[model samples]
Target: MGTTLLGIDTKEHCFEAQFHPKRPLLACACITGEVELHHFDRENRTHELAQSITSHSKSCRAAKFLTDSILASTGADKFAALSDLETGKQVWRCKLKAAGYSLLALDTERFAIGDDDGGLRIFEGRAPKAAVSWSENTDFISDLAMGVDGTSLCAVSGDGTLAVYDVRKSGEKGLIAMSDFQDDELLSVAILRRGTKVICGTQTGVLPIFSWGDFGDQKDRINGHSMSVDAMVKLAEDSIITGSSDGKLRVVAVHSKSLHSQILGILGEMSAEYPIERLSLSPDASTLACSSHGRPSVQLWSTEAARRLMEGESWESIFEVPDEGAEGEGAKADPTAAESDDDSSEEEQPKKKRRKEKKKGKKNVPGSNAKQHQAAKFFAGL
Candidate 1:
């Protein structure tokens, strides 16, 4: 079973939650235009409210730690502000041309924000204005990702296009490449495979893969989820954890060859029971934090536990829903099994029926277990 270390009830809908890059602190952006900071003790499995900063007048769409001591946030109010964590004071604020929808910190001194009008601006330090700004996307930018070296900036947009920029340049010179329009809206993005691949999650369940320096078309696609992949975070060079509208968190391995990329297998999974909206990995990569749409809580899971579990057994065997008869035996064996009734009740019947229908409708695909074996071998290497 996936080990849930902690859960926090914010009493309001949370749009995003992010962990500090170098601290045990978690910041949450709320629909009320507020930012809450919490300090967590992972070993003790406890979390306490640290500080609450009223950073925006309207819904705060995103919040990120520019430094261990500085919290930056952007909101639907069309403003971005930086807050000092020690004093809980707003040190810097700037108004934008449109409502800020996404934010990314390139480094301690540089940060970027994407707006509702397809505008993107990069600010240096706490400058009164953006040092560089551009509008290459035709719609709102949904997410932003930075290359490993921090010079290349990539943004995915609702217009179904991906835009890459050279942050070191300004004006038209900064625009590195723009992708052709995709069929589905791009919601989230991540740079993986040592900066050779750019993966974008779409409105559909598919993940479109773009090769570095080549953005005209996707090199490959991975259809691993049944619903929209709303959020994702790279866990390793070849692995990423994706949160989907299907209400499941899955660790997927992306294997790339000469010109194609495919999913090796799902290494681990945990059910959240709601559409996941945001995901964040701890700086140490030992914990994962996530928030779901319309849910007033944030959940933290132990990544170490997940890794150990995958090393021992296949992900499919670990998370597979048992037959109804087996559930009764499981409940009898573990008294606390009743606690999961709420999550499993709605899915149990339909899932079983679907499994039966799949078995009867078509011949089982060959080499299905080969993926599982490959996943086991991959985990061993990790």
Candidate 2:
């Protein structure tokens, strides 16, 4: 079956969309200061409106569902909100001195927020106390992602800095300061394979992967797309999926060095042509939720299709050009003459080819004259 837009809100301008960990529906929030919940059936690829919430005074940037039908959202108005999913009611909101950009639910009671003043704050569940707070940066944190077990946090700030913090430690565990590039902002981050490696997205279209717990080790940069990498999500233990401002979702196989990408655009532009803002994978590895800014679209992809693409045979033909089309194969493939040329070229070319190859090479060989003189002296001595 084909995919369908289950529902859309012209007023909300959805920026991020996330699914309930155990439920069949998804939730989203908008830059126009509203939140919405959507119910979907992937089997039929249909979406329906579940709820529309207007809780914040300013634009809401991030939202995620906690357990027990509870939701949490952050906005540009320096507030972190806790809501009831079924009732669409705000239970509590903790105010911060600076505007908050990202919300990560640690548990039903505790959550983490990255603020505009380059601060990382962890708030207690259902309480007013701060669990732990650190300001290791002087710039606003653009994106924050927690490890699978919630023991490690990866934060990328607006200053093009990426740092990982160990939450279990009483003091500091250390940090990996990533390389900065000109005219690029750190857009997003993700943890791979239970925090064994870290991936960071940048505005200049580079995805840098770092080994966990290895300070000062240079990261392996994966050059993927031509525009800003807005979101990255781990699909499996060995693979990742990225959504970009270029309106494409790319699955990168780290182990196999294979890539499967689809452009949802037309004429060398992102097809469906929306600016993809975020990506989130289901906990069971069955679905991918994509959120967009330009079209305010939330698209779900089949996890099985994603897995097949990741495990499929290599796609090396995308770079090659056939010498002849199938219609001209008979004229191009003189089987007997081609075999004879192969044998004759192999036998006749080696010695003659050596003289021609070394004509310009002998002068640049590192120690060729010294070795030759040494060999001559040894022969004379013998």
Q: Clashing residue pairs, candidate 2?
A: 6-47, 109-125, 264-271, 264-272, 265-270, 265-271
Candidate 1 Cα misplacement greater than 4 A, ranges: 256-273, 294-296, 305-313, 316-382
Q: Name the top lDDT candidate.
A: 1
Task: Give the per-residue lDDT digits (tens) of candidate 1, residues 1-382.
Answer: 4556787767576778999877788899887778988888888878888888999888787999988889888987889899998898889999999988889988888889998767899998888999999876666788999977668799887767777778987766777666666756788999989987889898777999887766666888887566677889987777677877655566655653421344333332334445676888888888898886434468887665445333444433565646553322111222111112223222111111111211211112223233222322221222
User: Would you estimate the TM-scores of all the predictions?
Assistant: 0.79, 0.73
Best by TM-score: 1
| Residue-level lDDT tens digits of model 2 in 83-183 | 88778788888787676777777777677788776677777776664577767544567678776656666777655556566665422332323222223
Q: What is the C-alpha lDDT of each candidate?
A: 0.71, 0.59
Reference-based lDDT, residue 171, model 2: 26
